[model samples]
Target: MTKHTGAWSGTVAKKSRAAFDGSNLYRRLAVRLDDGTTIDVEVGRALWRELEVGDRLVQDEGGTPHRGQSSTA
Candidate 1:
């Protein structure tokens, strides 16, 4: 068996919608990980506002990291 380890972080590059009735919209959260790999987090439009550029997110062999705010200082 093969185990899937989802590890990456980028930033939000773009966002879009379909009909405007809040039906088929996607919030693409781009992440630039420490390894230099970019990961795109395709979530709902309602949740895109919570993320921004330079926001750090980490995930290792354990599990997904908490979707909380990051510190720069």
Candidate 2:
């Protein structure tokens, strides 16, 4: 896993699940950042289930990932 700090906001490019050990899985989002860079951020299952491709997402400083402007609730 990579260490992501500061604030990052982006559009959801895609969703995926990764398996390392046979017994565990991790959900992730391939986000296209506002600056045009793509990043894969791991997320909780519940939240992962709630998002879709093209959805706008933002993670403010010291906050959790959530819907952003132009995204429907």
Candidate models: Cα lDDT each: 0.51, 0.87
The candidate maximizing lDDT is 2
Candidate 1 residue runs with Cα over 4 Å from true position = 1-23, 59-73
Candidate with maximal TM-score: 2
For candidate 2, the lDDT comes to 0.87
As a whole number from 0 to 100, the lDDT of residue 46 in candidate 2 is 90
Overall local distance difference test of candidate 1: 0.51
lDDT of 2 by residue, 1-73 (tens): 7756669898999999978777889899999998999998889989899899998889888787887886455
Residues 40-67, candidate 1, lDDT per residue (tens digit)? 5555544556555655555555465435
Error of 1 at 43 (Å): 2.2
What TM-score quantifies how close candidate 1 is to the native fold?
A: 0.50
